[model samples]
Target: MARQETQCVIHHSKLTSYCNVCGEFVCNLCKQSKYGKHEGHHYMTVTEKTNELKEEISEYQKMITDKSLKPLRENIHEHYLVKSRLDSNCDELTSEVEKREKHFIKEIQRASQKLKNIINGHRLEFSPGLASRIAQLEDKKREIDSLMKTCENVINTGNTYEILEFSKTKKSDLNTTHSSPRQVPKLELHTPRSGSLVGDSFGNIRKSRAIFTDEIKVLKSWSYDMYIENMFTRNDCVWISKTGFFVSVKPKTAEEVERKLCPVHPSGFIVTTSGEIIYSVSNEHCIYKITPALTVRLKHSYPYLPCGLCLAINGGFYVTMHKHGADGKIVHYFNEECADWLEIMCYRKGVSLLKKPIKIVENGNRDLWVVDAASESVIAMNSAGKFKFEYTGSRTCFEPIGICTDSRYNVLISDFGHKMIDILLQDGRFLTSIKLQPLGISRPMGLCVTKDGHLCVGQGNGCVHVLRY
Candidate 1:
């Protein structure tokens, strides 16, 4: 066996420096030597290199721990634990309710028994006398009573025994009638106020929604070449059907109208306010436009790749660019005269430009919403390219894939986690979450609000789910 060399072979000395240029450890003599391989190379002290490596290790550890494991599984496990505890607590509450119910039943039985006893005592005191009076009234009770008293008085003069018997019956009847009127039997029960119960038990549980049904009515389905990419609902449903483009005019009543082959393979598209559609093709710098008159023409040929676009409410249109190796920017084009796109918003503010923008939409405020996939955030900017705000999931961690807004300025974002759609306010406040997994909708990509107040959620692979908003 041969012993391994621990020292640098060239300098015959222990390692002292790390050559950053050559990516190797070297001795102090070799690192500074003019005749060695690492001569004149940028080098760091061994301790410095060790510290740098440690920092890198720390960064990688933090990435895996925080991003991969903690955010991914920790939230799930935490919810599962909470669900378990909630179930246990529910059972305990149910047991407590049963115990209370038994107590209430026993109390009610006792109250009912007391009422029954009072009624029975009333009956014992009144029935016999009432029945005898009714029987005698048929024979004229006033006259009979007078006659009986006279006969009793006459018999008492002759025989005192008959008078004693009549007196005994009369005494009993007088005692019963003269007694204090039986206490009226009345029922009372305690009830809690409805409005105050919610205030006490559930904190901030103000919004209440009644779900009519959980059944997913699978209204329509259409198959395309590859998969459904981007879609928008104007008066009609315009979508990229994998291989080409297609439109469903009356989607609620029909399936699809016709299929058109755009040989360039479109990436994303949007319907303009003037009944015209503008689309972008993959690896193509040209923006194509199609009119309702079925005319196809090239709108503009930019030097950079046009990715996604949205027609603005302010007579202009917003377009996002995807450069080869740089951050993308949204440009507002207002070419009212010809195919020449007049630039309106290209002033990029520092740290405000989108990294890699995908889809674009304009809100009621005429502000542009840019979905930047690289940054994992929906960037909102004013018409003048001023940064408005960034929504990157603060209430719950989610990947924003598709986004849409309703008439009430409610923003709905398709979350890639748990197959859900997150609802947000126009000013970026969390409202609610709509889970679509029950409907078997997965990888929700394209979202649009229809004209008749229905939400069309595109499930990537040529499948669309329609929901009544």
Candidate 2:
């Protein structure tokens, strides 16, 4: 090991000068020695060389401040402004809701008071009439008692004629009858029907309309000679598959870190949650798994040619395959142990489910998404193999090649024919399209979402485009 202080190995002296020709430090003895390597080489004093290098370093510092630091500072300021405006908007919305709530409460109280007044007026109008009717009935009962006393006195005189005379006199009184008592007024209350508060009477929050675009800004890109068939992202590195090779490249410098040779199918491969590389060979009808240590071994063999593969979040995996010589195609789900679990072939008795299922992926909801090239559509099915929906692009010539799902379960499909990527919901509804032609990406094929939520797109022109979508 060498010390921090530079020393000349041959001269056994402290280095004090810089050798320009050899680009190394040298001592005074080494420079002036007759048998020295720097005898004829250009040399300068240590102090002079330090001053000259300081000037160059000053220029580098200026470049860094102007080109990198300036933009970063501006971005920070812009973000601060955005955050301030967002906070202000939130406060304003809350104040508006509070005002509306106050108004609603006032209106309810006013309506209740008005209804109470009407009920009180009805009670006041009926009370007097009811009392007067009771008084008249009591007076009539006293008159009947007086007549009965006069009749009893005549009967006590032991005269049948007097009794008959009393009956005749009371005949008119007996026929008389008090009118029927007035019924208490019925109070039938009416109120508004109960329902959701989001209506004309009560305000509601409206969803912000999405601003669609046909272009996606490219963050960075790397050029290559071989066609990149697929991309799998793990952490900061991206693994791409070409004809007969699987290469892992660091995005920072676009430098190749590792390469493995495998003539994988165009649908390429997938990296499991456990960091295992799973790929398929169409001609051999086989699937291979590679560990993180670069050990490759045969994992499974299929009855038909296996094309595309994907892993589920629940420890299962899925694969799409085509019949050996028939037009029939199918998708198979394998359990956590890599054993066949379910086979999905036809949607019904006569209707087929898939035509040419190529790339496959499982979304956050456990729904399987398959890119069917022959049908020119992306197919979605539930975990139980039930058909969900098929999404054919708006364009007539929809040539979908790459398929991936984002953290939000938004399905992204790369179309080679239109040179665009379609963003869809997990339910197969199209949300928007990202045009790649404008970004100089002609053949957008392989797609993957990085761990940091960035999108990596592989093109047919042997270049991969990294986007911050």
- Candidate whose TM-score is highest: 2
Error of 2 at 211 (Å): 2.7
Residue-by-residue lDDT tens digits, candidate 2, 361-433: 8899888888876778888877545688888887988888988889999999998998888888777766677
Q: Which candidate should be chosen as best, given lDDT against the real structure?
A: 2
- Tens-digit lDDT track of model 1 for 7-86: 78676688778888988878877755574777767878888998999999999999899888888798899999999999
Question: How many residue pairs clash per model?
Answer: 0, 0
Off by over 4 Å in 1: 1-218, 236-240, 291-302, 336-349, 394-397
Instruction: List ranges where model 2 is wrong by over 4 Å.
Output: 1-215, 263-267, 292-303, 324-340, 346-350
Task: Tell me how many residue pairs clash in candidate 1.
Answer: 0
Question: What shift in Å separates residue 218 of candidate 1 from its native position after superposition?
Answer: 4.7
Q: Model 1, 446: alpha-carbon shift in Å?
A: 0.8
